[model samples]
Target: MPSIHDILTKAVALHNGGQPERAAALYRDVLAVEPAEPHSLHLLGLQMRRAGCEAEGIALMARSLLLAPTLAPALFNQARALQDSGRLDEAIAHFRRKLEVDPNCGVTSIVLGNEALARGRLDEAERILRRAAALEAGGAFASRLRRALERVTTARGIARDAADPSLPPGLVVRGAFRDSSGYAHKVRQFVRHLVDAGVRVRLVDLNHGDVDNLPDGQIDPLLHTLDRPVRAKAVLSFTTPLVVEAVPNLKTINYTVFEALDIPPLWAAHSRRHDHVVVATDSSRRAWLQAGHPADRVHICPEGVEPLEPGRVAPAAILDGTGRRLADYRVRILNVSDLNSRKNLEGLLRVWLRTTRAEDDAALLLKAGKGDGASGSIRDLLARLTAETGRTLGEAAPLFLVEGKLSDTDMMSLHAAATHYWSMSHGEGWDLPMAQAGAMGLTLLAPDHSAYHAYLNGRVAHMIPSHVTPALDGYRGRDWWTPDEAAAARLLRAVIDDPDGTRLSAREHLLEHFSWRSAAHRLIGLLGGLDAL
Candidate 1:
């Protein structure tokens, strides 16, 4: 005869092992033995919900809540089920109830904000989102929230018709690839509007990667690489190298270079770099001049999110092989990044393991790309960590490694499947994925750094204090970049110990700021008006 702990542990093992039905059966058996057991009932309810039995799961969770109203898990589950069933009002009540029990529920804060958004209360939505973002200290969610707040402000500005058509055709921008992408996308929109107003626009991709499905009338690759004459009226480079390197081809009336950060080494290499440089923000411009970039060349321009299309109802690709869908991965934390020295994944793994041990049914998922020579090393390390932790590989909280580049469709599908995204990079050129996840409305854990804070603003991610050097005194891995057995165990515990209510908030954030159409328009403006401005 198995002890109660034995049975419950087995059920959790089955659930984490990708056998939800079997786990649910074990949970049911436990419930049969102890009908009012809140833990058993709650686990069973989650399994049911994961299996797409929403109503049954909701009923079970509600009953569990009745038996143990103080159970934050049950309340949170009930709320999530209600939201899944489109009962937004009821869902809000349950989320509020969960928060009432645990005010520090980061996930609940996001869900509540989403609920407010669903009710069409923009101000309430913004406030609730801001609160959620603010809770993570200086995390990705907070940065995202700041961006969201900016969007709200921008929307208001647009609504009041405060921004006018500015900049002329044939604008050029270059800089660090990521930040440049944001500005380029926005500037592209300005160009498209100009094209509609009968202006010809040319684009340049200093970054080698193809712009995913950019529409026509935008700059094509051939134009930038092949020494095509830039006949624009004005020339602007997000980085100075763009103008300095192509000065001969440029026939613009004025050459303006726009830089958002400290000047790169590439800029200093050019003597007659640019006619003028536009600085997007005052603080950033000041930093550039302080860093020795001439102050006389700087100009100020306000930056915004690349306008995106409103997300629409599309058939979400069920992540079939993973044996779990987005709905199934509820409360699961998804971390996507290259397994390298800069990421500082060990700390996140520690938090995850601790949370999982505290909660019984949690799982930590990692989706990583294979780059450099780190892939095989990471795999071997993970396997060793699992074994040392007394965890069975692919059974007791697995590490799902997805190598290689992914298409946008595949990426978005994975995004849709995640409950939360955790990123702890020491430095960020710009955490695009964090924004994408936030736009998709995923709760994020990000580091408290200037780059993330500057872009995410304050609404979408939870930011934590980061150290200049990772604390590695006790780390067993010889390399700081690799995971130690102890760290792995801690991370595993965090996922299974407690659920984060950030999933709801992530979905809501996406609906507000992430759209393809909007992104396209922004790209047009950035590229089309290079010549005139």
Candidate 2:
């Protein structure tokens, strides 16, 4: 029942699976049967190019596209060849042609924009880059294009400021919130949304934190510059009338107003000094009101998550194809968080130790991105728990540790691979990874509090069923920690025993509630309110 298309699909799969030489043969066989198949032609052509047959691959791809002008991939491949071949004019035309066919294509627009910049067509490059950014929410290529545009715009701003001398004053929001540890990358979402919605927005990130323990691309490298203080003082002198505070760093001190901007009136004071202020939280509304800044002057917009496009390539190709399931070996429960004291990893550890059924088939997998700061303490606690639990569970039941910060794409892939996503955080500002897991259709088990609860309908995710008891200090905080060792045993028994039916339903709940497109629409509505501002 398989057609030539199916066979070609398999060939593409083989190519993706790292057997490109074998894939090349299958592709050739397909071409022998149907010489004009554009998809196979384009893909094989790309493979050929990558394998060092540039001229032959370029000619084949160009011929394939000429035979089928509507094939976007072919057009893209042809543009790549043209660019490398030093035919800029032809490359630009074909790149734009790809976008004309598929306006949502990000790669084409990026290349076209980059070429435009290379040719000194700044305005055209800017327009194309912005459009491309909207299409692909997050990617290294898109990030590079955006940073390039920022550099160009900043240069122009400096030139204009020099000519005019007196400029329209403004404020730039910077700084991190208490719960914004893992979700710091989402700040770009806020800045981009504001820019696309017609607000003049600028981003200045030095990644001013310690690079020693931080993950790559998570923080800006410029922040650690030895001349940061001198540069900061200079920037402060430059933006005299315009203020910058309430942001993460104390960079621009020479500017007017040194107040932090979390909510409304607090934000409004800066807006009163300038034209507008950006607010990260709704609680800032009270601050703005107290500062006597009108609602119109303060822009209230939360950061957004732009969903990754469904991979153009299939998922089966990406997998190892060993065909193993959790039941075959130990069941791995993954918890993603930094190894920080505040994250409450200890509570989960305590719960794991008391559970009886977990002693047999379960292995706790903690994925920590941050360096091993408090890891010795955590390992010691985990070892103690394993010692107590292993009496019944056996010696093979100790927990395993895998520590490294994964990129957004790799993290999503891992979430798709996980048995269940667990979040035992004390609190989260946006909880981007949890939302991403939901979007990836993974079963999530989380604490029922803070912004996590606000995003999920309470009935959806599994909450630990326990009433608040007094803390060790006898303080009045709610008891999220399980004191009754039996409670932990009961919770584990319920989750593991009903794995199939319960897990399927939990996945269904995620598909219904958390999605990238749905989040994007919500963001659009939020931006709509800024018209009054």
- Model 1 residue 223 CA deviation (Å) reads 10
Model 1 C-alpha RMSD to native? 24.8
C-alpha lDDT (0 to 100) for residue 152 of candidate 1: 47
On a 0 to 1 TM-score scale, where does candidate 1 land against the true structure?
0.45
- For model 2, what is the C-alpha lDDT against the true structure? 0.52
The segments of candidate 1 whose C-alpha lies over 4 angstroms from its true place after superposition are 1-169, 172-199, 205-230, 234-244, 249-290, 295-327, 350-367, 370-377, 381-396, 455-460, 470-532
TM-score list, all predictions: 0.45, 0.46
> Lowest-lDDT window of 10 residues in candidate 1?
473-482
Model 2 lDDT tens row, 209-253: 334433445444332221111111012111212123221121222
